[model samples]
Target: MSDRNPGMELDLEWVSRVRVNTQAVLKRAQQIQGRKLVKKQWEAAWLLRAVTCIDLTTLAGDDTPSNVHRLCLKATQPVRYDLLKELDMHDKGITTAAVCVYPSRVADAVKFLKAANSSLAVASVATGFPAGQTPLETRLEEVRLAVQDGAREIDIVINRTLALSAQWEALYQEIRQCREACGDAHMKTILAVGELGPFTTVYKASLVAMMAGSDFIKTSTGKETTNATYPVAVVMARAIRDYFLRTGHKVGFKPAGGIRTAKDSLVWLTLMKEELGDEWAEPHLFRLGASTLLADIERQIYHHVTGRYAAYQELPLA
Candidate 1:
């Protein structure tokens, strides 16, 4: 884990005046989408880089130990050996950043990863993931239990009701409680920006979450009607930059949901490079929370290596 954001006293003053220029943010999103990596080798290289930042996740209701085992295996060997060999990147020890699963499946994920002798970190979604409607006590207990189950990272969902009602201090304190419950595990705060009202509210929530010691601020839970979007991402990226400038604390940004293509992954990396520079593009400072995204990326890589797209059964399921 990176140096934990030691957290600061909630600055109500900073949270109050936060406002986002909607049109500017929209325009920036368009620009990011319009960017394209020029050369085949350069595009392939960036896609490989994106592969290393994936938080390979399985958060479905039907998640089982067997499926989690498959997910872990895929995480360990995300790209096929032949493909990596074609790019001469096989020996670089490339792999997804982590394997994210439900709190109950934390033990299974840990067990499988260890059995494979793979060092990939195990992450668990806690504190009523996708819906932070549980009681505070319940949420805290959930976080503690996931840690006890051997999760090195904890993804917590912030209560949207508090932020929607302009409960800044309440939101900070609650996130603080969740951070305290995380112990040694890294805490990833999910703003669920789609449900958090407007872009301004998204910015405010990002600030509050970072101040409360979130190692990373995520965009969505993938369960919302709207998940990660570029416009909302611009707001969050600026908030990360603002916090870093003021406190010298470099927090991470993760845009989960709706990001499922290799091209989409490159655009996200571009946003990070453009907004926060190259350091944030590393696995420690950035993560792509995705499920099928890896598969499409591998397909793209396959095409890059062979000059033609692979058949449906050409690559193993991710």
Candidate 2:
């Protein structure tokens, strides 16, 4: 596991002077998909590993204890038992990295996970997630409330308005407060990249978040018109690497929204391995913020095992 970053004083010089070569980032991202594909058993193995790094999520307005129970069940058993047996991986005890939900559902996720006797992390989206428009006090209270409810990870969305206005100090302090409220809970800061205009600001936002004690710097909230594009992720990866070099602290990276295919998961894993090395490829350091991704991954695993794709009905719903 990568070492936890305790955060550092906000460095305006580093944050303000950050730059991202848009063309170079875009070119590298394009090349990731072009890399040689992992096939057969190796491909299956990678997909399974990817499953372990997924933040299984359900953030809909209609979410309740019932569906949250199902989400927790899926997290504990992401792959079908029979499918795992086919690959002789049943004994491996595979599970998703965590189950993510709205702050209100934190207790339900925690309750279900405990009943299952699983210690899988329960991540809550706090601080007015998806928009971060709530007042600062209210948002901080939400973070504390989620932690009080047993969320082990808090995915906080940064105020894009601050980033857009270049409020570096305010952004840094705000995230620091969220980190403080998190206490022992891990903090994953969502930069909402799609809304943050330009590659340079994306890079800077990544830096400020890491310096503010974000355990993971996420690509988006998955609610924007554009989410988790490769270019934006590549930029974030560079910042994570740079931070690691300077502080000897490791921060994880998560890409949410529009990532829903087995092949797509492989591409993301490949990106992490290439950009951040194998250390960041593990479940603790790398996570895919996805809801529909597991189904597709399970389908691919089924096809690989049986040489025939299973219909959607054959696999259990998440």
Candidate 3:
């Protein structure tokens, strides 16, 4: 042992290695296919840390009254409704940040969600959803209806046709209108990254939406065939992180669609942590728009906390 304390030497060595590894991971990520977009996925791993909730947005299609009622009861029937709650009581995992639902079903979502936790937000889909091809007027109306119905967050898909067409002006106007329609509600502009031409287009669209006042930039609606990818998310995250660095305003990110496993969530979380740091970890800043992903995370947690595999039926569902 040198003059320095052995413990001090170990601490310094560990810190140095952590710095080196973090830098290497980030640099390697940047060189990857969607390197520019992987920031959030990596950052989320460490930022918010642990498991995050994913709203399976399209799980209930064409929200008719009966369907809405059923979903409402299912989402907010109380954890006490869960048999597992009988034995131990505490805030289980992370509380779901929002109850995502269709615009027409916002009111029903609001009713049950409020009963569960008043602060928990109600998010609604709008602006032509998966296609995002509706006329601007129709899209605005969609947003209006959702807000009026009590949705505090609105997710609108970008008009990819215009984006791919390189009609930045048209795309900018559409997002601006959608943002305006949101009024006080949080506006998340979905780039539909997979179908939006290229990662470069994703970056430009993200900038345009952020300029037009998007509170968050989402990767997909979880309805698209290609949904979200690590590369696409990397591009979007870099844009937001860089924007914050230059403008002093932090924006949120949501990588929706096709993300369904604890490992998948971990990949995004790792991206977020490595790219954006800890500030973006909370539900407010980072969210995985997944419907079936949470249960898997719960299962993993159960296994870790207790030494046995958690049975499927025994686990609670949102």
TM-score, per-candidate, Cα-based: 0.99, 0.99, 0.78
Candidate 3 total steric clashes: 25
Q: Write the per-residue lDDT of candidate 2 for residues 35-112, one digit (tens) a residue.
A: 998999999999999999999999999998999999999999999999999899999989999999999999999999
Q: Of the candidates shown, which would achieve the greatest lDDT relative to the real structure?
A: 2
lDDT (C-alpha) at residue 176 in model 3: 77
Score each candidate by Cα lDDT.
0.93, 0.94, 0.66
Candidate 3, residues 1-318: lDDT per residue as tens digits?
A: 001100100122221221123354345555543433333334323212334344434346666655655444444422222333432334454355666787877887777656655456778888988788778899899999999989888988888898788676677777877877888888888888878755667777777777667888899877678888776776778778766765677788899888777667767766777679875666668878877776666665555445577887887554
Off by over 4 Å in 2: none
Residue 269 of candidate 1: its Cα lDDT? Answer: 94
Models, CA RMSD each: 0.8, 0.8, 11.7
Clashes within 3 Å, all models in order:
0, 0, 25
Identify the superior model by TM-score, candidate 2 or candidate 3.
Answer: 2
